[model samples]
Target: MSELTPLDKAEAAAKEAATDTVAVQLALAAVELAKAATAQQPAHSPACSHQHKPGRSTGEWLAIGCAVCVGGVGIAFASIAIAIGGISVAILAVVLRSLWRDYQRDVQKGR
Candidate 1:
């Protein structure tokens, strides 16, 4: 049988340590994300909010813009005119799109 050299053993040990470090990091991240998701009481009202990661998805901006735009339209229609069911439809589309974008980003970022 062949014996391993000191450097070879050290390399193997380092590789094992790297694996363990990655696993631990992954676990910690999952815990933090779960905590973030479940911690907040969803703000007291619409005026409250939060920030995003440094890098946000394209769809995130689209969703945010659509939500604001269509939401305004809906209110305009509700309080003023009545022929713009399209505004309600836009709101729904934006909501669904934002949800889908968030889900995709979370999955990709492994959180």
Candidate 2:
């Protein structure tokens, strides 16, 4: 049997990591949904033991907030890029616009 190349190993590791991340995110969503459902119930409800509190420390909460902010920004940019076709096209448009402006300025300076 042939040994796996370094790139192959890295790709396999990345796939595994992505799977694990999805699983963890699903689990966290399930927990949050459960908590929200339970919170809506009466205080005397039999299932209100409060054992499912996935409370995070201040730093952890701050980290989550930062992650959410970054993710939101990324999604916004991705949506814009998709709406205008590929990101490469959008980037090229911006670069060309800048170059055009620079060329116009240089032409004016030469006159």
Candidate 3:
């Protein structure tokens, strides 16, 4: 292997310094981001924090389960109602149109 010349050594040192400077700048940017993230959050006072209770009780969970079941049943019933109502409305429209045509024919015939 050939010995590195002074110029080569100087270039290598300068590259290393540049890499270190970039690393330090990235680290500083990360720290600023972390600081900004923390600053964005609202600081909760100890008293205010305690006022809001965390987690649900067994009764609350049971109530939620019942509500979900009822909601599912309601949605099923609503879907059925909408389907039947749409079919009924379509049939009614067809019947009404035919009746209207017949009435017009009778009127034209002076009946």
Candidate 4:
């Protein structure tokens, strides 16, 4: 390759500087756009006003209480059913064991 002349070197440097300047300008424009967007928006929006009412009404509280009571009763019934099932399984096991023992005893006596 031929050696670059001073004029060519200066032109190449100018082109590189132009590209860098454009990139910096674009970054600055983005920052300005963001600032403008934030300026247009209110810090405390009127749409988020919690001025109407706070906390539950009397009827709402009553409904919540009734729901809790119903849930408790359902849980109690489920516990009772589980207990009855456990007792039934235990009784069945005991009866089966007794029958097996009697059968074995009879077989031994016959032999």
lDDT top scorer: 4
Q: How would you order the candidates by lDDT, starting with the best?
A: 4, 3, 2, 1
Error of 3 at 58 (Å): 2.9
Off by over 4 Å in 2: 1-54, 86-111
Off by over 4 Å in 4: 1-53
Q: For residues 1-111, write the lDDT of model 4, one tens digit per residue.
A: 599999999999998898779787898899999999999997887876566768898999999999999999999999999999999999999999999999999999995
Cα lDDT tens digits for candidate 3, 1-111: 599999999999998898779787899899999999999987873545455568999999999999999999999999999999999999999999999999999999999
- Per-model CA lDDT versus the true structure: 0.86, 0.91, 0.93, 0.94
Cand. 3 Cα-lDDT: 0.93
Candidate 1 ranges beyond 4 A from true positions: 1-82
Q: lDDT at 75 for candidate 2?
A: 100
- What TM-score number comes out for model 1? 0.25
Q: lDDT tens digits, residues 5-103, model 1?
A: 999999999988987797888998999999998787565556637874598789999999999999999898787555466688889999999999999
Most TM-score-accurate candidate: 4
lDDT of 2 by residue, 26-102 (tens): 99999999999999978775755567877789999999999999999999999997887886888999999999999
- Candidate 1 or 3, higher lDDT? 3
Model 2 residue 9 CA deviation (Å) reads 99
Candidate 1 residue-wise lDDT at 13: 100
- State each candidate's clash count: 0, 0, 0, 0
